[model samples]
Target: MSSNKVYVVGVGMTKFEKPGARDWDYPDMAREAGTKALEDAGLDYREIQQAYVGYVYGESTAGQRAVYELGMTGLPVVNVNNNCSTGSTALYLATQAIRGGLAECTLALGFEKMQPGSLGSTYDDREQPMMKHLLALAELQEFAMPPAPYMFGAAGKEHQERYGTTNEQFAKVGVKNHRHSVNNPYAQFQDVYTLEEVLASRQVYGPLTKLQCSPTSDGSGAVILASEAFVDQHGLGDQAVEIVGQSMVTDMQSTFDDKSAQSLVGKEMTRKAARDVYEQAGIGPDDIDVIELHDCFSANELLTYEALGLCGEGEAGKLIDNDDTTYGGRWVVNPSGGLISKGHPLGATGLAQCSELTWQLRGTADARQVESAAGSNGVALQHNIGLGGAVVVTAYKKP
Candidate 1:
């Protein structure tokens, strides 16, 4: 099928809150976000030809129920679940529809109403989806902690043993993201902390403090995608953010073959996905001015620097030391605070990243905006990953 240009004409998100902190349910979250997005684009619900809704914890037909709150027009509502990458998976599908000439306008919406505390297996009667990853990790290291932190922390420890990455370096990520969250009104935790404060926060695993981990959140985010023709017809040219490139990759043979902790948690998958997106966009990492990467854990952020080609392997620590990833640096990353501080409502995470990047490119991110976001050569990059595992990398720029 021939491809057509796709643009994000509008984006919106609920202020991420702790699970059970808000009285509203998933449908309400979807409505607020979806309505804002439609309004932002000056489009009516009837204009949307298709919709995709993503959530990890939900009943069957939940997508239909959620979209019904927006409009009962019976448009196709595809439910998506790809672990934490669910949101971007939905966005990826919507992009395909427009690119393939199936739909001119589509909505990608995601939300999660999570249970408080560390994530765990939901069904003991059935085999866990992460069994393969868990088994692979067991071969490389002992499992003494919860699965999530232990896996990522083991990767951090590996980076240390191989490259002398210190706990201080990993802690710096927590500092940078939390500090960035202060300027974002939508972040769940806005209070900043010193390096010592972050390090001293209760340790969940080796070099990982509670501060570095993404909290289970309850929120929703929505984005409206349109074909280039639709954008022109709707007079959305000024606000449209073009999706120059996007790629989603799952686990590879190296994930199990390399027996490396980072590889186990999707290092190579991210690398290949980022490579594909750069090739598709016809731009490299150097052209990016802002980023909204998945920082489910601070360690993953450091490892992703190498995976996304932002830095060489084992040199992520030096990147942090040079302050190259924050304001007044080489790139302003996680300007919306990322999952670390903004909260990780699994399904909502990727759409939140999309929303943040869209706002950045439009020069409307206000206090959380990057100074170089409007640079002629600048583009925004987004990375979202899940441990089962899947990763989506996307590049965006103002039209």
Candidate 2:
């Protein structure tokens, strides 16, 4: 069956921050972002036919709460939680619903109010006996290998060794992102940092300094998607951002269980997504002008460069060193300052990436704007990776 055409009509986001001892909750943030998106799209909440909300820590029926804040509506509300990829998954679901003719207009909302504490530890669910057993096993295995590297940190080290990536090089990622963040009004870390400062910062894990890690942040981002017919009817044809390709893949749950550090799961899934997008949009990665990849850690970005075929294996370091990935350069990556500087509120990140890309495609990203390499026909790629590199890639095009 031919895939139904879907278009993103509007996108909105709340500033990323630490909440600053406020009473504002996830539903409030979600409603605010969603309302802004609807306004941007020149549509009303009543026009929305379906909604998907992404949240990791929000209460059950959080999707309903957010939509009800706008005004109690009868739209079907589905909640999604897929680790860090929740936002992207929500977007994927909304796109599918519209594309399948199940809905004319759908809203994908991602929000999170980060609780103070180490989020990584929250994965251990004491209620789940199996999860408790797994945690114990993980702890025992960790003790067996002295300084075995923290879960994600170990992956960074492995990539570092294979790619000859250095602490300074990783520091550069933080430096560049922090600098970019200064231009982003909504970014959590707006302060710029020099490479020396980043290098001197306290190390959290191996070569990764505190600045390289994403902070626990509270934020929300929303995107409104409509069928091609809806876009045409609303006189929003010119504002429509087409959904060209989308794919998601899951890998082995245990990071330690994987025989190889660099799993093809993400790579293959991204490739397949890219292929589907290329086939549908008649455009390839080479044709993409801007990209936003999950940079929960600096190494994740490096690995993604290779995994996304932006460069070959072991060549991502060179890409960063040469400044090929920064804004205004060839194929700008993370022009919105990325998770490192923009803040990663878990569930909000994926939709935030899409918001940034939509801004770029609309030529609204003032200082960080690319030269419109794709011209009026701009293309963007959003890449999100979950725990152990569960991957999703979505491609967008503006015609």
Candidate 3:
């Protein structure tokens, strides 16, 4: 017997903003995002049988805190924290619950109220969760930059050494994402920059300028998921977007065995996850019309292009140079601006990607909608990864 199919019937998120720009807390963010998602789905809080909330920096039961403020439904709320991928991990759980017949309707919510500047540890007394990853990274190389930048930067540098990808090509990604953000009302940064401007910005790490990095942000995003039966019961076929296929893969031996920074920073994991998702969906990368990828840094975004099989290995630079990753290209990527401009609020980033993809698939993205999305034949792709480490790749199709 096959597992029941799951679908996303509603998705919503608050506009991402700089850390201090918002006068709101996580609960307030959750209240608005969750309420919007509930309204989008035409359902009440009481109708949600379960809730999975994701956050990185919060007290225990933060899930309960966020949801209770939305309404005292007293649902089985589960809190999740999986580094940057927390949002989609929550989403993964909700999809599983519905697919497993444990719940007919579920909510996956993610929120983060982050501090300004580059990320740092909140609790230093205990062992860092990424100590092992750092140890593995040390065996290969070390740089003066912080661990996050060093890992991803080292990966980019290695790609340059091996593939001859230029710093300008990487900057082009920042330019494209920022330009794309100009059409995205939810993006934190809407100002467009020329490729030269992007290249001249303050450097964050090797080949990555400040413009190429995703800033610490404050935001919340949520999605309502339901089973086919629930969709049929509620007559939600038109609003639903089927989770065509999904996969979550962790770091394999290649992360350490290959002794490559790219592998250490999640290239291999993303590769495996994308392959699994495509196989499950019975479709290839060429079938995808639009994408919301995890571009925490431009380097990752370019590397991801090759990892996702959008182009031949080491050809991502060429792909970007040819403008194949933007509008009027093979795929319209990061139409919501991706993390580089959309803002990455740890746990909230993944669900926000979901919101963007659902809108694109439904042809409801307004100004950001891709030309391919007009005929309602759009198939959206999502990629979200967190180092130390897990990667989730999902495919969505119009209902």
Candidate 4:
């Protein structure tokens, strides 16, 4: 199908914080991020012909309520919830609108005001969305901890047992990300930690330490997308970051049948999404100068390396051992400090990833700037996963 190209002309996000750190609601976070996005794009809210607002814990029509805080122009406001990937799902919808010529401009926004402590089910009356994953985990490991840490920590243990990935390697991710966060003003945990410190930090489950898991966060993120014509009309050439390739995938049979931590945690979905994105963009993993991906747990980040073709199976340990996934390495992964340090606010996570990548491509990442992205290749990649499960992988490049 013929399609108009979609480009991200502006992006904004609230500085992620721990739950109850701020008394503000999701709408308040949404307004701050949305207003900043408009100002970044030099466009008013009225110029946004449509919008997709994403959140996981909120009332019905929360999308409408959040965007209404921006200004009600009667624009279509779609509520989106794909667990943690809600932000990217909303982004994907907005991209479709512009690419399909349905709208010249669109807004993709996400926010969450989460309760403190570990996440819990909001609906006890209905079947859990993650029942399949949970059932598989029950067979593989006992649930002695919160669902997230239990699954992820078990996944880390499985990785170590299978691939000889040591706990030190897992702790290394938290150390690197936290060190990276020292330069990021928006990160919730900015203090740096040593490898020893990370490993010694309170163990949440199995090999997963407190420093390796993403904290419950309250935040919002928004990005403005425009068609080529809109970019030209608005003279947003310098700021625009083209959506070179994007793909979203859901769980398949492997997620249930494999029984391995990798498969149990939507590893196949990440692989499928990344493979398709690479094929569509006509670029391999080596072409990517920077990346912003979901690192809800250090284990997930390690698994993602293999899924995204950064390394071969069982080779992620070596990748981490050599420090190949950080600055001055083959690829700069999670230069925003990642979810481990930057904080993950459910729906806001994906859009926050998008916002960070846009800043990297635009060479405005401040101290976290990826020098390579400002060079000739100028490319960025984003990956977000929701364990129900869905995964979105998007490739971006300077226009």
Candidate 5:
């Protein structure tokens, strides 16, 4: 099947923040980000043919509420929830709509409000008590299913033994992200921490310090996608960021139920997604200049290096140690501080990653720009993984 072409015309995001003393709801953030996106695109809300809103824990008709707040005109709105990948998945849907000629222009919005007190068990199943019991047990065990030769802390221990991926090394990720967060006006955590400070912090998931985990945050991000024809018609051909490739994959849920650290399911799914994207775009990993991987945990980022084929298996530590993934390195990863430093508002994360890539491809990522090598067309990749190993990858190129 021939791939349909699409373009990203505008992207916007609100400053990620922990819900503070003031009363700011998810719709508030959504309107702010969505308005900013429309303004950035030099278009009005009326120009949008459709809207896709992604949220995980928001109330029913949350998208409608936001759209109403933004002066709704009865445009069709579809709400989507796909765990952490909600935002990126929404973007994918919008792209497909435009590519399939279903719509000339679409708005993709992702927003979330941090639910008070422990996120309130969205995974609970009232229909199947037995399944719910198993899920509860898994949660109590920190999502580890035993007797499968893989436990929750097994990977950490193995990493420690093999590559000396210490708790401190893991802590370093938090410290680095916080340091970068200090410069991000939109980041939730502005306070920077030292490596020693992170090491001294409280532990969350054993070897993974509190600082290493992303906090529940309130934020929103939006992107405007248009068909190639629409972009040309609007005289925005030069301003559009080409969607070179995109892919999505889902693994057997039973694989995660098995809880094997050696279960390459997540990695394998991401690899297949990347392969599909590369084939569609006629490019390879070597052509990508920047990347934003789902970094809900520091270890996840390490695993992504291999998943994206950036390095061989077990070489992620070396890549990080050599600073190969930093700004001036061969491939820059997570210059937006990632979820670790920027904060993860579940639904908003994936779109935020795409927004970061849009900036990088447009040469507008001030202070975190990666200088593309000679004859190298700047390319950026966004990777998002949802619950139970659902993966999506999107590739973009500077026009």
Candidate 6:
């Protein structure tokens, strides 16, 4: 397909809050984020020709209702849901509109108002979306924990048993992300914890502590996508960050065929998507200066290091021990605190990642900024995934 240059001209998000802690609904969340994004771009709601809104636990026309909070422009509003990757999926579609010349300007917005406690299916009348994956887990290990923690924790256990990865390595992810959140005003948890505290916290399953898992969150995020012509026409060149490459991959047969816990949680899908993004961007992992990867659980973060080609297979433990993924390391990852510390509102998570990377590439991220991304040649990568399953890998660069 033919494509045109697409750029993120503006981005905004609300401080992620524990669900029910905020007395807002999805529409309220949408208005704050959408207004900030429009103001950031120096544009009006009418200027957006289309919108894509993402959420997982809402009724029909929720997208339309949310968009109406911004304006009743009658633009086509597409509702999207792909489990945890919903936000970036909306982003992928909006970028496609600009890239395909279908729209000069578009809005990708995501918000979620979730119930507290561990995630469970809304409907038990039908088979769960992750039933197949659950069956695979049952065939391999005892299925005694909640679905989300069990699958992810089982993957971490497999990594430990197979690759000699230690529980401490996974716990470090929690420690680093929590520490990084101290500098981010939007993170849900800002207090730092020691490795002992993280490991000593309530154990969910395997090596995963309660501190390592993302909490149910209520928040919203929005990004404005513009074509090159639109950007230049509006004199918005200075703030535009280019979306150089992107790819989305779903589960493959190997996901179930491999009979491995890691594969069951989207390890292979992430690897394929990351490779495609690198090829499209004409750069390798070595070129990336910063990252905002999905760390729904600390275990997934470690698994993603190898999946994103940041290190060799079974070498994630070594990389963690060598201090290669934090500030002053080879690459600064999850500088926005990641989902573990930042809070995961499903639909809002990916847009939050995009906002952070855009700030990093623009050298506007304050205390959490990575020095490498503040340079003229800075490049950033984003990885967001959902099991049962899909993954979106994106590459961004300062324009």
Residues 61-120 of candidate 6 have per-residue lDDT tens digits of 899999899899889999999999999999999999998999999999999999999888
* lDDT of candidates 1 onward, in order: 0.93, 0.77, 0.91, 0.91, 0.76, 0.94
For candidate 3, the per-residue lDDT at 339 reads 98
Identify the candidate with maximal lDDT. 6
Model 2 worst lDDT window (10 residues): 140-149
Give the per-residue lDDT digits (tens) of candidate 2, residues 1-399.
Answer: 247898999999999887554568887888788888988999989999988999888678887887787777787899988878899999989998988889999999999888764564454546631243235335433422212124445556666777787777777888878888777888888898888998888777667777887777898999999998899899998777887888776654443354334442244445455566567676766788999887877767777777777888878778888998886567888888999999988888999999888888888888877767336878899998766345678888785
Ranking by TM-score: 6, 1, 4, 3, 2, 5
Candidate order, lDDT descending: 6, 1, 4, 3, 2, 5
**Model 3, stretches more than 4 Å misplaced?**
none
For candidate 1, lDDT tens digit of each residue in 1-399?
256999999899999999998899999999999998999999999999999999999888888888899999979999999999999999999999999999999999999989999988778998899888988888888886589999999999999999999999999999999999999999999989999999999999888999999999999999999999999998999999999999999999989999899999999999999999999989998989999998999999999999999999899999999999999999998998889999999989999999999988888889987878975555999999998999999999877
Candidate 6 local lDDT, residue 6:
94
**What TM-score does candidate 3 get on C-alpha atoms?**
0.98
lDDT of 4 by residue, 92-179 (tens): 9999899888999999999999999999999899998888788889888887758988888888888888989999999999998998
TM-score of 2: 0.90
Candidate 5 displacement at residue 398 in angstroms: 1.1
Query: In model 6, where do residues sit more than 4 Å from their true spots?
Result: none
Cα deviation of 359 in candidate 4 (Å)? 0.8
Residue pairs in collision within model 2: none
What's each prediction's TM-score? Answer: 0.99, 0.90, 0.98, 0.98, 0.89, 0.99
Candidate 6 Cα lDDT to native: 0.94
Candidate 4 to native Cα RMSD, angstroms = 1.0
* Candidate 2 vs candidate 6, lDDT winner: 6
lDDT of 3 by residue, 1-399 (tens): 136999999898999999989799999999999999999999988999999999998999989999997788778999999899999999998998988899999999999999998888889899997787778877767655477877888889989999999999999999999999998988999999999999999998899999999999999999999999999999999989999888888888888888888998899999999988898888898889999999999999999999999998899999999999999999999999999998999889999999999988888889999878645667889999999899988999876
